[model samples]
Target: MLNRTSLLAAPALAAALLFSAPAAQAQISTPAASPKSTVTQRVGLTDITITYSRPSLKGRQAFGTLVPFGKRWRTGANQTTSIKFSDDVTVEGKKIPAGEYGIYTIPNKTEWLVVFNKSTKQGADVDGFKDDQDVARVSVKPYKLGNKVETFTIGFSDITPATANVDMMWELTGAKFKVTSEVEPKVMAQIDEKVIKNASPSANDLAAAAVYYYDNDKDLKQALAWMQKANATDPKFWNVHTEAKIRLKMKDYKGTVASAEQSKKLALDAKNADYVKMNEDLIVEAKKTGKL
Candidate 1:
């Protein structure tokens, strides 16, 4: 036996009570703690995402001190160290095609060698690293940490508009990798045309252009002309003296012999080991063919 107004007012009161109870409780409760650190970066063409817990510095010396030296490290805590590449690349003179891989490092006082393993399985140790699955391994020099670093850090340096160097430093060990963008032939051709059109030709540019055409396009006549121009412009460009060696492949022994002598003289003047060795090899080949 309630009035219609009373019934409507009761419903409104109950709804208000229900909502107010939760709001009061929420006001008194503490908020959840935030994460310590987060890492997100792009390697080459691939995207890399990482989340890790930061270690404490209380009475614990990092790197070469408390951690000791000449040991293998997980590179980071929680999850395994991971990297992703957008395109194919070479690491430490080893070929690592475009893909994702886990990164690990072995530390020493002198240098630290970084390893790119092709596994993403959690809690896997360096012993689990399979040789066939290895993408690349590079050795990098490490420097002393001047200031105390509480957290691990990785970043890039020596960044040009076109290229960059990736640096991974933590604890007592670190490594660096040089990354160069892959240039397409069409793009390179455009660059070459632009460079030639805009600037005065020099021995360096002509020699580079000649070698590129000869090696990439196999245009022998153009290569010879460019090599001749390089020799005329600056007789010091080593490749110009070596062009005759390539002509030997075309059975031009006389050209080879002449080029070898020029290469030898330049090598002697410059004191270049590789060039000197190359000259000696070419002379032997020329004499064998009765062209010397």
Candidate 2:
């Protein structure tokens, strides 16, 4: 009986030891906050979203230490990073229509070439990249980073009501691309004239016209007038809240505060997340200016 008991106890102790090793390692490595980051931006008429796992310097040499220079980086990790365009736009002087594509970058200290390939499934390496799948390739100048960034990050900078800059940083290398949010006024004018002439304008037509007037033309009075018409026509239309953003851009802090507050209440009643966020952002801006 003693021998049998000893044999059973020995096996149980070995199993516990085996399980504890992995658990201990996991606990030691896990961080208080996850290291992953994501950036989403709308390009022209297309929506571009990028998800990447951030790497840190952490006492190691960056540039060549972490991400080697002159190598093709997936630009992110895990999944092949992707950029989706809502409409066709010009990148690096080459016109690319609205579509989804994989983003790969060749990193260098002085400059980096941003490649937009039609192949969204291609891996980080150039080995799988197809020459025929190439869309547009642009060379972007790299800038010196003032601070040591531990993790990879991408976001919009120099943001305005109409435009923003998409900033990419990894290791010691970084690049920026200008993004324009407004469609051409000629296009908007055509749409407005056609819609009004042929039939009564719908909510979407008014929304598009308002955006064009506000963003492209910088005509706040016209934009506000159109938006007011849109709200009266369809109070339930979710986009009327966006008018607050235009009001903010026009530097009408008082008008922006009022529009944003009203939009927030309307969005809450309608249960629209996009409008809710827009109103929330506007309210934050209003409070910053002591207008809220």
Candidate 3:
């Protein structure tokens, strides 16, 4: 009853039926190794950002062993470690313009050479690296840590209004470089344009200008004048409190005691216990200085 065509088609049809259902769909898997990380910090007037991958020690030897000595490392795992600056900055006394760069470091026993390459899009290898493409380079001393750091890390430490120290650490070794941003000129220009020349600046604007001048050790006379303007506009307790401090700095103890008394009264009415205490202490200091 089986014809030649039917006999051949029978096996083909059976095979098709036996494998008709699609194979199970593939599933996504998690990463098994280094993970990406990002850090952003505002130091002075500049915004600094770093993007890289963190690789763990995993009980393996690092530094001279895995990372190699006297050779450039990507400064992190995976793609090149990238650093971005929103404004021009000086790194380790070398000027670097505002932009993004790929960080590469050559390590040694006593020192490490930090590099900021103009190129950003690159793999961890140095196949296409050119020394002429470097934006800046500086040598930093490496220090040993007492405690072991299991994962590689980069962070900003010892931060000030105009400077920050960028620290890179892995295993028991660490290196640091300082980044400084110019802030005085920027703030001074703003002060001159916004508060000094403005005909009808608000109380808050005047107060802000006064605070900046006072904090930056600028012309205290101008600071006192601005604070006086703010106080004349509102006569608020906080405004008077700042005036008292400025007067103290100017050695006007009598003025300090007078303004501090007003601040203490207003602070009590506002139920601000902290400001009241501060004014009281300032008054005591003013009396001791024979200015009251």
Candidate 4:
């Protein structure tokens, strides 16, 4: 049993509340001004990851103005930027163990000091940190960019089999530091255990070990022997091409020409012109100076 006055008051109250609500309201899903970014790259067998926020210029100067010159910066806006490494790495020849670290930087006109601090979390700033806890510090020269970069960026560049660069760029300036990992010894150990010491190695294993040795400039005689075993029967053109290269390096002109010719014939039968041309080049090189 509802009273008429109560029913009328409910409608009036609802209308008043709807009209009197604040004009400004918080959105549950709004984009951040400085959005978070993540980048990961593998140098050798190590996985390097970076997590940070990207802040845009928005008509203001970036270097020396917004991010002052020669002062330790948090490396990004909002929270501290973090870098993680899966294995021990050498940064600019200074070694740092595998773990997470906060990145701080001292930007300048010619060079920059990149710091890897042990403190990872703080109250949204890098002001409360000390240099005693730093894992590694490196000074890297800065490069000028022709075009402007509105937002801050961190990436891995100049990647090779065992090395890479941690590149940081903002506005018209860029800085980078080299990172190298100890991959050769680990790879060599694995190869020695699996292929060298094994009583019977597969064709694929032998070919792989031989190629690694050839690329690394190990004993050419051993490489040739393994390659010969791998290519003794049912040889692929690519494998034979590698054998030709090894023989050429060893200056076995006759063997080089024979292996290259065989590879050329197999390549022609397989409808691959690239290998055919490669073998022709090797044959020409071997026949040069009347060596054969």
Q: How many residue pairs clash in each candidate?
A: 3, 6, 0, 0
Best candidate according to lDDT: 3
User: If scored against the real structure, what TM-score would every candidate get?
Assistant: 0.46, 0.56, 0.88, 0.86
List candidate 4 stretches off by more than 4 Å: 1-27, 123-127
lDDT of 4 by residue, 106-132 (tens): 888888998898886652344676777
List where candidate 2 sits over 4 angstroms from the true fold: 1-36, 43-45, 160-163, 180-182, 185-195, 198-292
Ranking by TM-score: 3, 4, 2, 1
The segments of candidate 1 whose C-alpha lies over 4 angstroms from its true place after superposition are 1-56, 65-68, 122-131, 171-174, 184-186, 189-292
Q: 1 or 2: which has the higher lDDT?
A: 2
Provide the overall lDDT of each model, using Cα atoms, as 2-decimal numbers: 0.65, 0.71, 0.91, 0.89
lDDT string, candidate 1, 153-265, tens digits = 66667754334666665554456777654544544575367445746667766777776666565667767776787787678627855587557766777888788888888
Top of the candidates by TM-score: 3
- Report each candidate's C-alpha RMSD, comma-separated, in the order given: 13.5, 10.0, 4.4, 4.0
lDDT of 4: 0.89
